[model samples]
Target: MALHFRTLLAAAFLLVPATFAVAQDNEPDVDCDNAMTQMDMNICAHRDYETADTELNAVYKKAMDAAREMDVQAKDMGEHYVGAVNALKRAQRAWIGYRDGQCELAGFAARGGSMEPMLVSGCLADLTRKRTAELKTVYESEN
Candidate 1:
């Protein structure tokens, strides 16, 4: 299973530059204002996803901290926090699986093409933005 996963990963990387005229290591500095080539578009999309992921991480941390504090207060009151923290951890794990699976499906829509990575990354960014909003709601509710 591990070997299969590694092989799949390698195949995905091979598709990353399959259609791009530019070499993998020579991806030019992207100018989102004017992404002229397919490679540029893919690069820009991946960067956007990275930004979304970073924001999601920040929101998740804040939400988890809030959950922890609520657990502490519940303990002081001789009641449980209803497993809020554990529930969040579990939900997050499930959401991660859903996100990766969704993106992989999207990538397969453009299978063996340079645009596959871009499609996958765009799906990731869109889902991550929604997840960040959901996490913020938990943080707000705890306040």
Candidate 2:
């Protein structure tokens, strides 16, 4: 099974470059503003996803802090409130799972093709930006 997995991985690595070469044959230059080749599109989409992920991380930290504060206030009041920090952590984990699955489904649109990476990354970026906005709304409302 391990050998079979390795063989599949090697074949996938080989096929990806061949697919990219087919795309690069038409457009050699990579311009993020006007991504012409599949490789360029993939690179641009990954960059966008990275940017969104960074923004989401920043928002998540702030939300976590807000949750911590709520937990502290509840403790100070001696009230048996559901832990905000725990709830936020649980919700974030679930969101991550959902995002990964949804983006993977989106990649099925161009499965095994040169455009699959671009589709997946685009979906990731869109979802991450929306999640960041949601975190901001949820936490900022308390402030």
Candidate 3:
């Protein structure tokens, strides 16, 4: 039993990075290949890239609003408020890249599937939900 557990853990450890690498290898190419027409393809690619951009912007705005609220709670909290807001902004930007990359990867999965648009949309929704949770954490921590 002990050996079986150890083997399983080792296998999981090794598989994690390999899975990540395979996912990374698949994302951009999948998005690139899914376009049925040149225009539609370009649009699909743009939409995939923009998903993160839009989510990041929304997170930034939410963070800023939270910071402002915090500022109103205590005047001397400016520096801390600003710092949290800035951190959230930076995180948001990074999240945008993460979201886009993940979505691109998901797009690859959709390539051979019949419901590509639905798959892509689901990916975007999941990413958005994640970003919202991140923003909420930042907001709650500052308060």
Q: List TM-score per model, in order.
A: 0.77, 0.77, 0.46
Model 2's lDDT to the true fold? 0.91
TM-score of 2: 0.77
Candidate 1 residue 106 Cα shift, in angstroms, is 0.9
Candidate 3, 60-135: lDDT as tens digits: 6777888676666655755544454555567767877887788768878758565565566668767776777667
- Scored by lDDT, the top model is 2
The stretch of ten residues in a row with the least summed lDDT in candidate 2 is: 22-31
Question: lDDT tens string, model 1, 52-133?
Answer: 9999999999999988887887886676545779989999999999999999999999999999988999999999999999
Q: Against the hidden true structure, what lDDT does model 3 obtain?
A: 0.68
Off by over 4 Å in 1: 1-27, 77-82
lDDT of each: 0.89, 0.91, 0.68
Per model, how many backbone clashes are there? 0, 0, 1
**Across residues 21-139, which tens digit of lDDT does each residue of candidate 2 receive?**
88957654567999777788898998899999999999999999998888887897676784888988999999999999999999999999999999999999999999999899768
Model 1 lDDT vs. the true structure? 0.89
